[model samples]
Target chain A: MRTPLGKVRNHGAGAAGTGHFIAQRSTAIALAVLAPWFVVNSALSLKGGNYLGAIDFLTQPLNAVGVILLVLIAFYHMWLGMQEVILDYIHRPFTKVLLLLLNTFGLIAFGAGAVFAVLMVNFGA
Target chain B: MAGATRPQRPLSPHVQVWRWHVTMLTSILHRVTGVALYGAALGLALWLMAAAAGAEVFGPTHEFLLSPIGQVALYLIVAAVAYHLANGIRHLVFDSGAGLQPADASTSAWFAIFFAIAAPIGLWALVTFGG
Candidate 1:
């Protein structure tokens, strides 16, 4: 029995599965640590009361880096999570192919958008 | 007996029927937390796009975020963040082939429960003290 309190047992699921699970979890843990910072930074950002001011605040170390890292980690974790969902739900040959394609492209888009926004902030200032 | 026979419906692996266990609860909570966090991510995206695009968009998004509904949603999202994180570690142990025994399952499950609760409470305290 795979009980949490007893002496830990082996999952016997093999290295490939364990590796995927571990990676999904590792990114998720990073995201968990990062989430509050992003939320608080976001909530505080609205206080400045103007476009330029919001931009200005984001230029600050805490907000700028907070947002940049937030975007990367969030998207990475999400991509990993979504891939599992797609694998479970989409069983067709062609549709699964497309969904996999979409997941990869979507993550890339998210990363690019985040980088673009940060660059804009830095250069626009 | 035939006259009194009852039909049995297919059951999804839901809360009922199965004996409730900590690992099971934590597993369900992880999925719940994940979906909730997705919604939160959407809200974040809106706010980000607004901030990037300028005041015309930022004004409405900002107002919504500070509203009662928005705040509640924000709170749930953060709470889910905590749950998912803690539960995620439990999963990590399972992933690493370390916590598959029933006793270890219970122990790690409790550990996740405590960790999850601690984080959101910490966030709420931050909001109360600072916001």
Candidate 2:
């Protein structure tokens, strides 16, 4: 049943084995920088559960940009990681496909919503 | 392919079959914390959206985030992030084809666990008392 060419290339169904690997690693590297900065900065700025402080922090141009980048990259990374988990464990074809779809679209929607919110706060929309 | 005629396949050893080790734990916890962070990201989005909706919306959201239950959730998210960050770096090092030796790998795994526990407590103390 094996096509010699298919066996030789062996890229699996996606035909891009290394793409996921590279994307995950690159995002991990970016998060290594972004996550720590966001955590420490938020910890300092948002102490006392200061609601107004959080709004002010997000309104700053640099901080707003950082938050948007964090949400996008973090959501992308989450999608890739969840995709792996679902593929590895979920054996039913239908369930697997459904989950994979939800994982991608859900993260995109959430990420877009977050970015939109940040822009709103910054632009006073 | 559908019945007893189906060929039996050799199955890989799973968690229940393997003896526990720090490396095994770090590997599992990386995924676990990753899933936890997924929820945290959703919370982040909701919080931001609430903030953008003005104080009437954020007021209650912020209060919930500061409530006892919310603090517990935040603490756990902090812990998850800490562990995932530490172990993730270990994995990146592993990707580079270095530190794969059992001793070095386990050492890094332990360090990651330690940091995960300590970082949140340290952060809490700093925020609570370091005024």
* Per-model DockQ: 0.22, 0.66
Which tens-of-lDDT digit does each residue in A1-125 have in candidate 2? 23467656875564466998999999999999999888878887797766688889998888998999999899989999999999999999899999999998999898999999999988886
- Please, what are the lDDT tens digits per residue for candidate 2 over residues B1-131? 57878778877879678777889889889999999899999999999999999989998998898899999998998899999999999999999999999999999999999999999999899888886
The whole-model C-alpha lDDT of candidate 1 against the native structure comes to 0.71
Each prediction's TM-score versus the true structure: 0.72, 0.89
Q: Can you write out model 1's per-residue Cα lDDT over A1-125, one digit (the tens) per residue?
A: 13453334564433356666667777777876787567666555554356777777777877777777888878778777777778878899799979878877966765676666666667663
Please give, as one word, the docking class of candidate 2: medium
Instruction: For model 2, give the interface RMSD.
Output: 1.1
Candidate number with greatest DockQ? 2
